[model samples]
Target: MAKITYIQTDGTSTIVDVKDGDSVMRGAKLNGVPGIVAECGGGASCGTCHVYVDKDNTRPLSTMHAVEDELLYCTASPRLDNSRLSCQIPVSDDVDGLVVHVPEKQI
Candidate 1:
């Protein structure tokens, strides 16, 4: 299992152990971490599961893909360079300490 942290807009943080191959969206939903609606499940079609890869800790994350990049434009929140769809990020041992920041809202 890989441990990941989800930081909310208000600065609250939730740390949970995520199973390998599970998307970050699943991790947040299963752990009851707020801000990830996952409207389309882990399909990467919904921007509702939007999150920002913590600039300080992205060693465990994969490079953004074209599909994910296209979907991010649909978010209600202001997308940043670090913005990513949680559903597009899978948990793995290498990303055990991954940290993501939740936006204030999702469209």
Candidate 2:
């Protein structure tokens, strides 16, 4: 299981043990991590699951695809270099201790 951390806007963090092959959005929603509004589920159709990949882990995360980039650009929050749609990140054993910071808002 991978240890995933979701940091909320109010400074509360929800840490969950994500199983391999699970998406970050699925893990967050299952663990009741607030601020993660996966409107389109894990389809990558909505950017509600936007997260900032910690600098240290950015390189290890999956590379952004064209669809993911489009979704990120459509998000209501300001996009960062490390911005990523959590749905695209599959939770696997290799991603243990992954930490993602949720944005202040998501539309």
Candidate 2 on 1-107: residue-level lDDT in tens?
79999887677888999888899999999988988899998998989999988778843667789999998988888999989999999987778888889998997
lDDT of 2: 0.88
| Regions more than 4 Å wrong, model 2 | none
The window of 10 residues in a row where model 1 has the poorest summed lDDT is: 56-65
The residue pairs found clashing in candidate 1 are none
TM-scores, all models, native as reference? 0.95, 0.94
lDDT for residue 69 in candidate 2, whole number 0-100: 96
Which ranges in model 1 have alpha carbons more than 4 Å from their true place?
none
Which stretch of 10 consecutive residues in model 2 shows the poorest summed lDDT?
54-63
